[model samples]
Target: MRVGCPKEIKNHEYRVGLTPGAVREYVAHGHEVLIESAAGAGIGADDSAYIAAGARIVGSAKEIFEKSDMVVKVKEPQPQEWAQLREGQILYTYLHLAPDPEQTNGLLASGVTAIAYETVTDDRGGLPLLAPMSEVAGRLAIQAGATALQKANGGRGILLGGVPGAIPAKVAIIGGGVVGLHAAKMAVGLGADVTIIDRSLPRLRQLDDIFNGRVHTRYSTIGDLEEEVFAADLVIGAVLIPGAAAPKLVSREMLSGMKKGAVIVDVAIDQGGCFETSHATTHSEPTYEVDGIIHYCVANMPGAVPITSAHALNNATLQHGLALADRGLRAIAEDKHLRNGLNVHKGRITNHAVADALGHEVHAPENLLYVA
Candidate 1:
């Protein structure tokens, strides 16, 4: 199998798909690895590193996409790269297709095997590939929110950790999953009064046990969320619905209830955001004011720290990449968890979540991979 790694082209996106170490492993397994020139440079990896790992450096994106049996990437393919996609080639990446009708249509027209990393599940029902980036985004959300809270940034000019004898900032985190948990950890560590709200009691109990009363856990309800947000200095929207778009838990009306100049870091912006006002922003223009509330809704928050994000993402995605390369898509189709990752195959929407998201008919991956 020939695998291709392309440099991310999204604005402010610096993470690369594969590292030299991953290239070496695939090469050692008797597979060919083609890396686009300067693909790893954004992640602090160079062509020489890939060459040392036995990878062939390709000059153009066209050659890499045209020659590879499988195309691995970090973000979804942009409009230019979308034209390069071919039928039967496998695309393994974070395809957030729910929000973008154009990307959904593009993948369908390309007739490729599209396996979304965000939807891929582990045996424990955890999103393995998405977790690493979620952890990074979660931690970064606090930092970004803190910066946005500064007076110059249109915030209340209150310090998160606060000074001696001053009141600490209050943080409200929506959801209790990986992203929410990490945000809570970071906020609490900074001495901010933290409150995590979730629908699951078990999850809230787990958070309670983990934090040992340092952070408050609330049974998530409309009233409870309203009360928390009304008093919050920073609100982090971290809700996710697997391959589907994120639920809008915070409405535009809710914004008026928050303190003036409070910041909202919607980490789920990639999944269409949980905040009603969030539009995908770039790192260069990461925040905007909505009713006196600041919104940090960068679609690729982890991309701000490419070196760390690339290595962390590579660590989680490498095993799955090897599985698809060694055993081919058929083996992945046979595995139930891996099969769930198949959003599109042969021009049909194979995942129900993605299908429902775009209002298309869902084709079972098994039906697409093998004839009955």
Candidate 2:
């Protein structure tokens, strides 16, 4: 199998799909690897490094897209990139198609087999492929919110940790999943008063035990949500619903109840944000003010730290990628986890969550792939 990676072209997105080490792994698997020139530039791996890893460096993204049997990427294909896709080529990447009908249409029109990393599941029912980036984005949420809370950034001019004579800034995190847990870790580390709201009582109890009462864990109810969000100086939107678009937990009217100058870091922005006001922003322009509330909803929050995120992502994706490279469609048929990752295949939506979100008919992956 010939696998290819192209340089990411998203706004301020610096993460690479394949790193030198990952390329070496593919080479070790007896597969030919093609990396577009400077594809690994964001992760500081130059052409020489890829060459040393036994990867052939191609001159253009178009060449990589045209020749590779399977295209491995960090982010979803941009308009131009998606336009280049053709039938039979495998597109293994993060396809947040639930919120973007245009991209979904593009994939369908191209007749490409699209396997979304975000929907890939583990035996434990966890999103294994999305976990690494989620962890990175979760931690970055606190950092971004803290910066946005500065007075110069149109925030309330309060320090997140606060001084001995001053009160600490309050942080409300909605969700007790990987993102929320990591956000709470960072916020609490900064000495901010933190509260995590979730509908799962068992998960809330687990978090309370983990934090040992350091951070408040509240049951997510309308009154509780309003009280916590309104009182908080920073609110981190960390909710997720697998391949589906994130539920809009914070409405436009609710913004009026939040504290003026409050910061909202929607870590769920990739799946459309939990905040009603969120539209994808780039790192170049990360925050926008809405009703006196600051929204930091950069769609690719993990891209801000490409080195760490790229390596972490590579680690999680390595095994599944190897499976695809070795057996192609057969890999998906054999592995249920990888099959769950199949969002679109041969012009049809294969993932139920994505199909429902986009109002498309779902093609059963079982019907599409022959395990035998």
Model 1: CA > 4 A from native: none
lDDT (tens digit, per residue) of candidate 2 on 228-345? 9999999999999999999999899999998999999999888999989999999999999999999998999899999999999999999999999999999999899999999988
Q: What 10-residue stretch in candidate 2 is worst by lDDT? A: 363-372
Give per-residue CA lDDT, model 1, range 220-293, as digits (tens): 88999999999999999999999998999999999998999999999999989999999999989999999999
Provide the lDDT at 29 for model 1.
85
Q: How many backbone clashes does every candidate have? A: 0, 0
- Tell how far residue 30 is off in model 1, in angstroms: 0.7
Candidate 2: what lDDT? Answer: 0.94
lDDT of each: 0.92, 0.94
The alpha-carbon lDDT assigned to residue 127 of candidate 1 equals: 95
> What are the clashing pairs of model 1?
none
What residue runs in model 2 are displaced by over 4 Å at the alpha carbon?
370-372
